[model samples]
Target: MNVAGARENVGSLVVHQSGIQCFNCKEFEHFAKECRKPKRVKDSAYHKEKMLLCKQAEQGVPLQAEQYDWLADTDEDIDEHELEAHYSYMGKIQEVPTADTCTNSEPLE
Candidate 1:
């Protein structure tokens, strides 16, 4: 006749009526797995910057001028010029294949 004792006897697999809280929003009434809130997104740029800093620290050398500039500039100042410079600098660092390097193509007729 005791519902609480009967529920306890039934086992812990049964969801409790209270004390459940969502990890996402830290709210009550729902478990984290059942939370309706959207998952948090990771900041890829921040992580990449951190990784670069770690690499620099391991090498015991200061960051390149462009990287130093990038780190010093605020997010709001990332205009077209800054982006172009970043891309150009990256291009200089990485070697890209040109038409002359293509070995699979026939000569022009």
Candidate 2:
């Protein structure tokens, strides 16, 4: 082969080898064994992708909703404490811990 043709072939081989990605940092053109940069730590993006991926263990299992029709049962009576707790959690502020914590600065006449 001509010198120019041989050089071209060698150049192509280098280009092909450079396409390999580094296992350490995930960048192209170098292998992990030859990596000069610091080892990469998993970032939020990596965690996000991990969270988004469905695990094999949950795939075949059917999702159960035993309380899906909870509203259908109306015969159950809500106790006063339960009602009050639910109301408080739903954001109807009935009372404050102290007068100073209350938004009303004026004294009650």
* Candidate 2 overall lDDT versus native: 0.43
* Model 2 deviation from native, Cα RMSD in Å: 21.1
**Model 1 segments beyond 4 Å from truth?**
1-12, 41-109
lDDT of 1 by residue, 43-108 (tens): 444434544665686788775433454344355555676566555544444445577986766653
N/CA/C clash count, model 1? 0
Model 2, span 1-109: residue lDDT tens = 3533322245446233344656457776555556798755444443332223323224543321211121122236757764555444445323444856777777643
Worst 10 residues of 1 by lDDT: 1-10
**Steric clash pairs (candidate 2):** none
For model 1 the TM-score comes to: 0.25
Cα lDDT listed for each candidate: 0.51, 0.43
What are the clash counts of all predictions, listed in order? 0, 0
Candidate maximizing lDDT: 1
Residue pairs of candidate 1 with colliding backbone atoms:
none
